[model samples]
Target: MMNLQKKKLYTLLALVALFVILFICNMLLSPYHMRIINLVGINIALVVSLNLTNGFCGVFSLGHAGFMAVGAYVAAILSLPLVKKAIILPELPKWLGSVELSFLPSLIIGGLVAAICALIIGYPVLRLRGHYLAVATLGFLVVIQVVITQLQDFTRGARGINGLTQYTNTWWVWIFTCITIYVVWRIINSAYGRGMMAIREDDLAAEAMGVNLTKYRLLAFCVGAFFAGIGGALWAHLITVVTPLSFSYDRTFSLVVMSVIGGMSSITGGVVGASLMTLVPELLRNLEVGITVGGISIPPLYGISQIVLSVVLIIVIIVRPKGIVGSREFSWNLFKKKKWNTMNQMEN
Candidate 1:
């Protein structure tokens, strides 16, 4: 028990340290680069949230982008300046046209709206397990896309909504990322999270052991949707635009790739995966080849980075199926002990 308490304390301190370092980096980085960091942070929230259902709960869900769209649209409608809407969307409802909120409140409202939608959808869809659930959720994604495309008055139809305020920055991103990581880590280490793992291991056994499978599964689904909603709102505010096509299968693929590459069961894996995937392509864009050893001047293809990453992910899965970190977490105990040893050696 005492050892468990020490472990918990050490984990908390490590998380604190990680946040401090991320905050400092955000403050020191240039605005342009900070935007990329913000993307990394948002993706971290998304991938980690998805892992709750897909990783810990062992449920395959491919429709997270639908929740994101719901949040983005809700937040966009609520947060758009009244004057801007008046000029752009004059035909909007009187209530929508009259109200405008700041960034933070808009994000919260968006998340809440998405959570409500998740509750409605999860109640019915969560009843289906495994492949049936995946197909149903995919259907939901298609339905959402169709609805968004058809909603001309509100969502601006196929042309999409524009002229949003870009209020998202490094500070906001890091703050939300910290909150997400803390909340998820705490939940996963709690009884509820443990019950989720039990269900994942064996639903029948878990049910026999008094674990409420349906309730816990639905809870994890809702929580995942909630964070995905927040990520969507942040993304919308950052880009200052919204298009139904943005949350399509391509987006879903990217999220899946990040989660799988990072390690499905590890939160730190998700963070690393998102960061590397998001930045690698951008970094590749700047690479230049001056000379070729074989007397052939070859410039890198624009999409080579993605192809390489795909190959790497495939190899990782085939060779080491458990992912780079497996279920291990980022903790301070290792670092603290190393530091203590180094100090003792120096003193001696």
Candidate 2:
């Protein structure tokens, strides 16, 4: 227990230090750099939440983008100024139109709404397994995008809500990212998590052993949807717009890539993958315009970043089919094991 407490202390201290550094960087960094940092936090929240269902529960879901859209539109609509609501969404009910809210409540409400939707959807959908479940969830996302497009009074009929208040910042984004990580970690280490993994490994055996497949699956799905909603709220406020185009099938595909590239079964893998996917593309932006090498004028290589990044992803998957981290997590215990191994080697 003492060792556990010490590890907790270390983790807390590390988080404090990282937060302080990020807070300082938030103030000092250039706008572009700040945006990148903020995006990293948003993606962290997203990819980690995704890992809860897709990774821990071993469920195939491709509707994360739809969940995000639900949250983004809900939060964005709520947080918009009363006047903006009146102008942008003239069709809003009088009660909703008249009401205006602060950021925190809006974000939470958005998440809850999304979770409720997920609960309703997952109840029946979770019964399906394999690619059937995948297709079902993906269809759900497609339906959501279509509904958003049709809700002209609420969503401006595909133009989307615009000029949203900027309540998202480095602090809110990263603090939520930390909360997401903690929540998923706790879930993973619980008995319930073990049951989920059992179901993943062998559903027939797990069901025979009295593991509740639908219950655990739904729990993971709802939890993941909740956090995905929060991430959507963060992204909406940061971008100051909520458009149907923003939360399309492509977004889901990219998130899946992040989960797979980092190791879908590992939380740290999600973080690493999110960081890599977010940063590498942005960092390589210069390659799009042109690169002057030793006074040699190189023509612009438009879309080069995508090509190179795709190649890198392919290589990573070819080398590590289980993902970069496989099923392993990054923990301090690993260092102890390494030290003990070295000591034994020396004695031998």
Candidate 3:
């Protein structure tokens, strides 16, 4: 017990130290670097949230982008200055046009609205399994995007809502990222999570074993939606815009790729995948710009990031089908096991 407590203490201290260093670095780094890190943190929230449904719960949902869109629009509208709201959404109802909120409240309200949306959508859609469910959820995404485009009074149509306050910083991103990781990790480690995993493994078997399929699946779906919404709100504040284009199929695909590459079943994998996905495009920016070496300039490699991502994804699917980490969660036990093995080898 004492050893476990000590381990927890050590982990907590290490995380605190790491955050301190990261905060310091954020202050020191260029705006580009800060933006990248902030993006990574937002992706972490997104990847883990999606991981809850698709990975742990074994639900194939393609509507993450849609939920995010809901959150982003709601939060942006609430947080937009009243004067700017009139200018941007002149057609909005008097009640909505006059309303303005602080950042945190807007963010929370956005997430809640998304959760409500999930509840409404989950009733009919959660019954389907496999590709059917996937298609259905994807349809929801399309429908939401279309609605946003049509509702010029509410969403400003294709033009979207801009001039949003930059309420998202590295601190906000990482704070939410940590909360997402903690919440999802705890839920996955709980008995209800075990039930969800059982459903994933075999829904019929899980049902036969007395696991309530509808209840648990809805729980996971709604929870996942809630966090996705929060992530969307964070992203909206970061970008200072809420366009339908921002939450398109491409965005959904990116989240899917992050979850898959990181090992959807593992929280640590979510972080790893999100970090890699966020960093890779930035790291490859030179490819998008001409590279000059030895007085010879090479033409820019447009779309190279996509090509690299595809190639890497294909390789991972072929070689490590379960992902970089599979279903295994990272632990200090790995180090302990290694030390024990080393001692045994020396004794031998």
Which candidate leads the pack in TM-score?
2
| Cα-lDDT of candidate 3 | 0.88
Model 3, span 164-231: residue lDDT tens: 99999988889899899889867876778889989999999999999999999999999999999999
Return the TM-score for candidate 3, rounded to 2 decimals: 0.94
Give a tens-digit lDDT track for model 1, residues 66-179.
Answer: 888888998998899888888777778898889898888989988988888888888899888888998888887888889989988888878888989998877677778878
Residue 155 CA displacement from its true place in model 1, Å: 0.8
Question: Candidate 3, 86: how far from true, in Å?
Answer: 1.4
lDDT of 1 at 306: 64
C-alpha lDDT of candidate 1 relative to the true structure: 0.80
Candidate 2 all-Cα RMSD = 4.0
lDDT of 2 by residue, 207-229 (tens): 99999888999999999999999
lDDT of 2 at 234: 94
Enumerate residue pairs that collide in model 2.
none
Question: What lDDT score belongs to each candidate, Candidate 1 first?
Answer: 0.80, 0.88, 0.88
Assess the local accuracy of residue 290 in candidate 1 as a C-alpha lDDT between 0 and 100: 33
lDDT of 1 at 8: 71
Pairwise lDDT winner, candidates 1 and 2 = 2
Quote the positional error of residue 256 for candidate 1 in Å: 1.5
